[model samples]
Target chain A: DAGITQSPRHKVTETGTPVTLRCHQTENHRYMYWYRQDPGHGLRLIHYSYGVKDTDKGEVSDGYSVSRSKTEDFLLTLESATSSQTSVYFCAISGSGDGLGFGYTFGSGTRLTVV
Target chain B: AQSVAQPEDQVNVAEGNPLTVKCTYSVSGNPYLFWYVQYPNRGLQFLLKYITGDNLVKGSYGFEAEFNKSQTSFHLKKPSALVSDSALYFCAVREKDTGRRALTFGSGTRLQVQP
Candidate 1:
């Protein structure tokens, strides 16, 4: 096991409301990433953090923001949730920046529904 | 930009028969390939990866993938299909020395093993 945990395995909220998803890892991985899985799109990167307080946006990052305050915690927030933002959010951690002897470990994922 | 492609949206096979899920990728430089499996309502589980080695790579749950550099394909295969192997499979790729560490995932292919 990679010691990764994601909170709120399922959630439902009204449109325009804000929602936050948390990803915690027991392993001290240097890189943390947030991805959303949608039908026909596989998993698209939303945001990722290479280190504490350092982050970058991804292809589908328009409706989301992310923060990493500690080595173990990465937080993903949707400022105003929309029906289109309803997706299964996953967290993945890697030991290195590149794929040099490193592979990603994914979390259980948070299923968000915007009603 | 690097990208992965899964040509088939679904693959059906009978139990005890061999199975294959095709994946192709486009990236500059040598590619780092990976495969993941996802059951319903679950997070993605790492299957196997090929960085630089012999063509065949074996992973958990009796899964193996062959990396064909010339064809730019990494196809997942199993000697015998199991009903339990029915799940969504994803292929991902990251190019070496691309300055981007994130993986580009292909659209998933659903695998159904009928008894």
Candidate 2:
């Protein structure tokens, strides 16, 4: 939770290759998210970005795809990798510009294992 | 399209006693609640939020939350229990004005805490 950062904390791909998961932040916080934590589906939202190219789609956006040109980087791509997309993948950041509920700052996950 | 419900996927306390981890939400207009905590791989953190006045909102370690907008629920309490306070617990929602603030989680609740 220190400025957010998630990148291959652990990975073991194979399914169909093509996999990218990276989210970096320096607390610029303008909202950037990409969640995926299975096990009864506790965390969905497959994509989110509020600026720097602006993004959308959530609620498990298809096979997942995202990119936030700049603004602290936010990329999550799984073009192929399957096996139900493995699990544990979280990257969150919120608009903590002193407004809008302030509650989000996660990044310590990225346990993808799509054997 | 905002929804969150952690109808007990797991909850069992013992330690010092007192503990409740339940959450319910369904935003449509006014709602910006949250409570996150994940340990054992780590990712989610932010412990409290209720973006308006105070229906009981304290956070961090001695967690607290109770923003029941007429039973929409936002339960997450801890009076004593501490077995290191178990882990995994999340409940989120956002819909104040719904310009797509991105936040709608709830599919987690696993707090053992037994000693």
Candidate 3:
């Protein structure tokens, strides 16, 4: 968990504004992920990256997008913020290819509020 | 589709009493199960994981989970509960053969330890 860091620890923006949350890692893990934590949703995957410049959508990827230009950096962007998008965003990394399982180490999380 | 289910939305147990939080999964082939805990205003912390060679996996903070292959369940348990043990718990799963390493998390179960 210490190796992962998420930027914008707390943010408040008006609806329709664009916002981006950054996740940086020092572990050089090949698999990086972005998840949103909501009341009943637990942690839903918004997007994930398998490698540099290779990303895919998750179950709740409608209003979100991700980019992984480097192995250590994974960014999640909201094209236009909405009230429904206000939730705590978490970034996770997996090094299973390095010989562990699918268990991930998560960043502290970024709390976003849209008014 | 691979998914995890945490039947109880909230579980309350008295201090010093045994506690259990139920979780079940549906996935193809052998599954990798994981448990995570989230304290207030923080990201998730890895508790334990069930990869192989162990039906009962012990994790941090005196928490343990029983992996029942036949029942498709991995319920978290603690012999004696503490007030500080109250937190939001999550169960996640990923198929071993899936290329994507991101886990699918359940709705989550809140454990409330009463004094």
Best by DockQ: 3
* TM-score, structure 3 vs. true: 0.97
Point out the worst 10-residue segment of candidate 2 chain A by lDDT.
A96-105
User: Runs in model 2 with CA error above 4 Å?
Assistant: A1-14, A17-35, A38-44, A47-56, A59-79, A82-85, A88-113, B1-14, B17-31, B35-54, B57-76, B82-87, B91-95, B99-114
| Model 2: colliding residue pairs | none
DockQ of each: 0.65, 0.32, 0.80
C-alpha root-mean-square deviation, candidate 1 = 1.8
Q: What shift in Å separates residue A28 of candidate 1 from its native position after superposition?
A: 0.5
In the range B1-115, model 3's lDDT, one tens digit per residue, is 8999999999999999999999999998989999999999888988999999979999999999999999999999999999999999999999988786889999999999999
**Count of backbone clashes, every candidate in sequence:** 0, 0, 0
Off by over 4 Å in 3: A97-100
lDDT for each residue of candidate 3 in A42-75, tens digit (9 for 90 to 100): 8999999999999999999998888999899999
Q: Candidate 1: list runs displaced more than 4 Å.
A: A96-100
TM-score of chain A of each: 0.94, 0.34, 0.95
Which ranking of candidates, highest DockQ first? 3, 1, 2
lDDT string for model 2 (A30-113, tens) is: 888888898888888888999899898887788878989999999999999989999989888888574336667789888999
